[model samples]
Target: MRKGLPILLALMMASTAVGARAESIGHADLARLNETVGAIGRRLADTDARKSDASALLTGRLAGIGAKGQWQVPTFDTLAGKPTLHTIPVDFMLAQLRLQTGGKFAPNAHKAIANGAAPALFIRGGVMSLDELAKLAATQHPGAIEQRGQSFIAHWPIVIWSDAGLVLSAGQQLELSTGEGAFVLNSGLFTIDRASLSSTPEKNAILPEFRPFLATAMTGAVQAREARFSNLGYGETGVTSGLSIVGAALYPAKMRSSFSDSSFVGLNAVSLENARDIAIVGNRFQKMVGPAIAMSGVTNSQILGNVMMGTRMAQAIDVQNRTSDIEITGNVVLNNRGSGIFIANDARDVTIEANLLSGNGRGGVSVVRSACIDISDNVIVSNAQVGIKIRASDALSLSGNDLIANAGAGISVLDQQKGALISVADNAFSANKSGLYGGAASEVALNANDFAGQSPILLDGEFAAYVPELLRMSSSPEGAPQAFTIHPNAKSTTGQTSRPDCKTGS
Candidate 1:
């Protein structure tokens, strides 16, 4: 201060001289302005120092925890029924569990521990019981937490009473050994990876019905990968109202009943009813008694990149009961007892694309009483019945597909009701019994398709009127046999033969 006083005095004199030349200005205002600027500079410097200290503290804490090679549990004095705020790392709480339980944790707990580092959580702490803390830890981490020696064996169902979260991390396993199913009463989120859930088989006369591994009536997301479900009756996984099931694997019992029971027929691998905004992606469904994936009254959903095989008595994927706006893409459906993909019961606005459907007992794709469907870019072959079958459907577009070696027609249209419009374009058909079969009342637009090695475009009943148009739109390679062949009984409504020479008739 003493050294700067002379310069400050000179500056003040200069300001006074300037003020005299101008209107009468005071020196006190200049002094106050200088002081305020100095104060602000000091405050900013302090703030930066504080921020540096905070950063150092966080770095040191993380380093210290790593150096210890074991978690250090924080000590907290209990305040019953009093709410307290805590800013703590989730690992600290997990460490506390290890301390309380003497390091004896379940396999799933260990999996939760290894999935990833725990996040620092700011929680409103209260009188949290151990159970509540376990659940919190499980939710914050990515694995399930189980109490020590808690047997899942029970005759009645295991019901989650309130809002909850369960997770099973990679390399973790959880088997629910129950005669009955598990249920979630309230909303929940379940994340599972590489886990198994199953039921113990009951003796004769005590067979369980509708005993799925996990069933929920609440709204949530079930995100699983490499998860397994087996030995459960009805469906292995089920959701009644709301949920998205993504990336799961489901298998039936090793030895299941063969009585052809209806309860077992309609429900098996995965069941969804009255669900919306759902997505089933990248799952494997194998050897199930009923449909691998069954939905009713569902809408606005996507089923993508899944594989379903060896279905016992139902379609690989079944959509029924007015489900609408569904997109099924890039799936492989093979060796099912019924149709590879079944769309029925007024389902509308559906798209099936880029799929491989083969070796199914029924048609590769079956549409019954549905409307506004688009099927494209699929390889449908070696099915016991037609490659693609449409019955009582309207506004169908079948394009850019490969239909080959099916036991029945490449494309079969039957019982086409009024107002139906079928469009066939850019498809390659080979070695099927018949390339296209049209039944009564079928109005077809055939365009730019390749037909080879079989009878192509067979029309029955009222469909004969479209023969000239179908012939004009279809073609075969040069030096190959003529592609279009008409049945002897085929007659146009204008009383003309089914010939290319015939004129187009209404």
Candidate 2:
């Protein structure tokens, strides 16, 4: 008897499945759908109904509950330009949009509205909903113009433009216009990491800029007025690096507290470590505590055409630790307390060219433990230390430089550096200590220079001094102190006993 019951239950289940599948929408069903739609249109509408209400009819037809407990939503393909007034409900419309366009409401809006009747809205059964009719109306209606009064309001986690409305995400071609009007973002704080919004004169598109703040961690600073803690991150480690505050200009006095308040002047430490293809150009870095650009363990970096000035305590450009193939050119560095440019700690294949450095307290340029560095066409002036310093380096070349007013040697090489082997040609040195100094270096070549300083430039250490005759300085008048003696009171005497030769192997 139990086996018989099992067989009967299986037969009954099969019959139910077949009946459900075989059931089809009937002509009566269609008639009822039409009637329900008409009734919906008349319910909330006045007798002198505007033509816009026709959208309700469309919503009702698409909102029918099927026999299988499934709901059907209308799509553009289903409408096919039929002219009956269809009122799409809001729920159906939002659902349709969410389904069809993947949350992009702008693209398909016009077509959806034009092809349907007046869209409808309802509040029933403890639920607020939109009929297909309302969807059609809203889609067809012109988008609201951005209102000026409500441009920036606090909207937790973000301060959005009142005019921009509710946007899940902005498209690539996003451009915000604050023309003749002011827009303020005052969300207490907001983030713009990797989201671009540019309204400058250059381009007119949404999201013109790619990375306003391209990082994960942020605190204060966006609209932090009178706030104590404010910071941004720009480290490549994907952890907190506190460098997104690099180029942001701020005033310390305006902040709420003076705990660690400082104004933004230049780039903080940028983590280009082990990263490749870095290019820094056309930036104005002023009064920064860190290097204008710091790259280490990186490859194929190009730092060019930047203005670095008034740094607090570091070099303008600091490259270190096995970096290679870097090109630094056409930059202006001024008034740094440290080196204008420094390449040290095993960097190789670096090219420093066409830079203008002046008023540096320390060495204008310094390269240590580096190889294949080409220094050319630079104007170094008024630095307290040597114009260029090379140590523990190899295959270095210096040419076409104007080293002026340096307190130390025009170009100094030490510790077996290949500076002497490099092509030192067509360089001009005026009022420098020693035009060129070499120590223990091999294979140096000095050719076609314009050395204008004290006569008989000194070379120290075990160097095979080539072109020592060419190292002669420009003429000085009777008592001009022969290249402005290191101490103003002292003078260079002519006698052999007075002249102590401080050459490498004297």
Model 2: lDDT equals 0.42
lDDT of 1 by residue, 404-489 (tens): 66888888888876545676666766556666776664555554565433333333234445445444434233333222322222
Poorest 10 consecutive residues of model 1 by lDDT? 253-262
Q: Candidate 2 on 271-328: residue-level lDDT in tens? A: 3444454445333455555565576666776765555666666787888988888988
- What's the residue-level lDDT of 274 in candidate 1? 56
* Residue 467 C-alpha lDDT in model 2: 26
- Candidate 2 deviation (Cα RMSD): 34.9
Q: What are the RMSDs of all candidates, in order? A: 29.8, 34.9
Off by over 4 Å in 1: 1-156, 180-186, 208-210, 235-267, 456-469, 472-506
After superposition, candidate 2 runs with Cα above 4 Å error: 1-241, 244-267, 417-420, 453-506
**Model 1 pairs whose backbones collide:** 143-167, 144-167
TM-score of every candidate relative to the true structure: 0.58, 0.45
